[model samples]
Target: MSKELLKGNVAIAEAALRAGLQAYFGYPITPQTELLEHLSKRMIELDRVFLQAESEVAAINMVYGAACTGVRVMSSSSSPGVSLMQEGLSYIAGSELPCVIVDIMRGGPGLGNILPSQGDYFQVTRSAGHGDYRPIVLAPASVQEAIDFTVLAFDLADKYRHLVLVVADGLIGLMMEPCELPPFQPVRTTRPDWALTGADERERNVITSIYLKGEEMEGYNIKTQERLATIRATEQRWVEHLTDDCDLLIVGYGTAGRIAYTAIDEARSKGLRVGLLRPQTLYPFPEQRVAELAEQVERLLVVEMNAGQMLEDVKLAVAGRAPVDFFGRMGGMVPMPDEIVSAIDESFAKMAQPA
Candidate 1:
């Protein structure tokens, strides 16, 4: 199959189109504007529903409305924009609606900058929205992986009937690469039988997130947790390199992960016993893998482009069995490959210290 050289944002848009997106509602921001722009034209050409909503909040609610009809709906936004949509996302999750959300992360805390940053990791993985619901989080490091995850996101959204997040940094959104686009499938506009279609199925089916009774809400929470448990057991994915023979393990996700892989490779060349573990799923995080690697390595290093956002998770996974260290570059700065290699050298030196 021939691959198309395309920007990551555009590639993800096309992948979603092929994956049978019935509706798309979004408000544009930098880095991810290309994705919405591409979908605007493609969705129109395909005679599907595409709306440039007035604001991020309105856009996500639009997705909520479409998803209730059992259609494949999506919304994309950057960091600050995503913040505006949190309430809507929580409502969608609480209602058990299936929709795909694409977040091309930018610097944060308060419209920091348009430059790429992983500052949203905590907001995405830990507190996507208010409440205890967990959305499936997929962190794609490359343009090709972005496309693959976009396609898979739709399937997972429908299979589990819940929100699925496709997370990418501004770098991934802007970078261009050759991607083998997935095959296009015919989309169905008909609503599912369980949908609210105005009494056409001999009964009034109501869809809602509001449970008036306390006990009823608890039951809903339990059901959501049970499904989340199955997802945690089945969806953990990661890449391990030279971990089997190493004494120090470095873990990262998305861009930082790619960099760690290279740094660990170079460290091995310099006779350092360091390895790499790159997580593909941010939620349902590879905690089991982290624990297993802790048993083999002397120390664990958590690398990120934030102020150690993921570092907390790595600590929980390690659970004090092996000491864990954090290395991060906050704001818009990126950590270099040599910097990670240097961190590995320092970890060894620290381990040699008497505790």
Candidate 2:
């Protein structure tokens, strides 16, 4: 397939469609609005399901309804808009419904800005909604990644019968890059065995998140935890850059990680043994890889576009094996390459100091 210059959000939208997405329900929100906009027309032209719901709340609930029918369904929104979908998300998750959600993160605490920010790190990774389950999160660093991860997100969601989130900062959402979209997959005609298709089967299938009895709820929780453990063990993914024989390591993801690549290259030219570990799966978190790298590096620096949210996870993974330092920008500020390089130097200097 020929690579086309595509914007991130549009690429994701098209990729989702080609991945056999049967339905799309979303509200318009900046940075991510283009995704819904693109789908709005394409879905109609293709005679697939597409609806602009009254609100983010309505959109996610609509996704919940569509997913119960065992179709490849999804929704997209920015940070605050995603917040509105949390309850519905929890409902979908509890019911063990497979669905995909895309979060094009924007600056926030409350309506912070429409610019890129990884502020939703905690919101998405540490259980996107209330309760113990964490969604499988894919962080895309470029437009190509955005496209690939969208397809992957659908597959993983169905494989596990759980929610999967493709998260990117506003930068990746708005940026344009050359990307080759996947070939279209035909939509599935038959519903899965577990789907609620009018209960006409030999045995009635009950799909729900509510376990009314205390013992039943506890049992369900145990089952969910076990599923999460399996996902964590098998799905941890990350990209290592110049990791071999490096004394200083950097940990970042999404846009922050993308910028760190440039900083690491510059730091390498400056004779610094700096490397980068960019996580692709945020929930699985690539903890094992980080722990292994921690044993080799003298210190680690974590960069973020938020107030060091993922820093805590990096620290936990290191477990005091190496000193972990953090640098971040909040409320829509993206760190520059030189800024990260400077932070790398500061980390080295800190390492040189007496404990």
Please, what are the lDDT tens digits per residue for candidate 1 over residues 295-330? 889999999999988888889898999999888887
- Residue pairs that clash (backbone atoms under 3 angstroms), model 1: none
What lDDT score goes with residue 298 in model 1?
94
Best by lDDT: 2
* TM agreement with the true structure for every prediction: 0.97, 0.99
- For each of the candidates, give the backbone clash count: 0, 0
Write down the RMSD of all candidates, one decimal each.
1.2, 0.8
Q: What lDDT score is found at residue 280 in candidate 1?
A: 90
Q: Which candidate number has the best TM-score? A: 2
